[model samples]
Target: MSKLLARIAGYLSNRTLVGVDKLGNRYFTRTEEIDGIMKEKRCVIFKGEGDPTSISVEWICWLNGQRKRAPTAEEQMELEARREPVKQNVAFLKQEEEERRAKEGSSHKAKSTGKTGGPDLKSFIHQFPTEGNKLEEESDAVDRGRGEDEAGAQKAKEPLSE
Candidate 1:
């Protein structure tokens, strides 16, 4: 009971109200001597049911010590105001994309003749030489060119060898 009383007294004395979020959640900080060194502790008192998702990014940063100071109400309001336009732009872009896709889909459906069979592979193959023969012929031609060049070089060297 004495320990509980001491803890209550400590909290009442040391805890400092840092800020309140838009959701009515309260943020606080307190300094305590631990291991003979002063350390600051931060915490939040949720407005209602303690849903952590209710916290904003700025407050989360402050709570996590990523930010040295809590965000001001004006800063929060300004950020929220800025976010509104971005949200509208994103919604507009999504709607535009959906409209474009719908147009493309309708056009495709109109153009597509219901004749649904696989593509004419025979006609495609006819557009090029027989694959096996073409590859072998190309390799043979390359080898022949290299052999002729090597023979010519050897012939030129033979005269110099004399």
Candidate 2:
């Protein structure tokens, strides 16, 4: 019904029916001058739902000028084949993340940060070891060189309280 009306409208408006999808959506185009430059005016009159999302990715590309024309059968098949790996990769990542969460510490399973609004110090320090934090390593070495007894003796050597 609408297709017939579209054909009539196309003829009257000088727009040509460029392509039709399997779902019955019709793509129409016509040449019109915009800013004195002749350009092809394109639009899609949806068949049933008229929803933009109903347009296939390939059709969307053509409509948006990413493609010269509607995708061929081979191109659609190739796209479908390519999607298989991406879908599998996404599923694998989700499963791996779930396993990580299951094995992770309960504290990490909740919020990663402390109550002070700072990063999780334990996790951060563990991930990036003392190798990168030379200051902390040096402080530890100095503390070890000066034993607790020696530290106490050094403090005692200071002037007595008045």
Per-candidate local distance difference test: 0.92, 0.82
Look at candidate 1 and give me any clashing residue pairs: none
Write model 1 residue lDDT over 1-162, tens digit each, in one string.
999998898677889889999999999999999999999999999988999999999999999999998999999999999999999999999999989879999878545667699777998878677756897798899999999999999888886644
Clashing residue pairs found in predicted model 2: none
Any runs in candidate 2 off by more than 4 Å, and if so which?
A: 1-6, 20-25, 47-57, 105-108, 113-162
- Superposed by TM-score, candidate 2 places the C-alpha of residue 22 at a distance from the truth, in angstroms, of 6.0
Best by TM-score: 1
Report the lDDT of model 1 for residue 85. 97
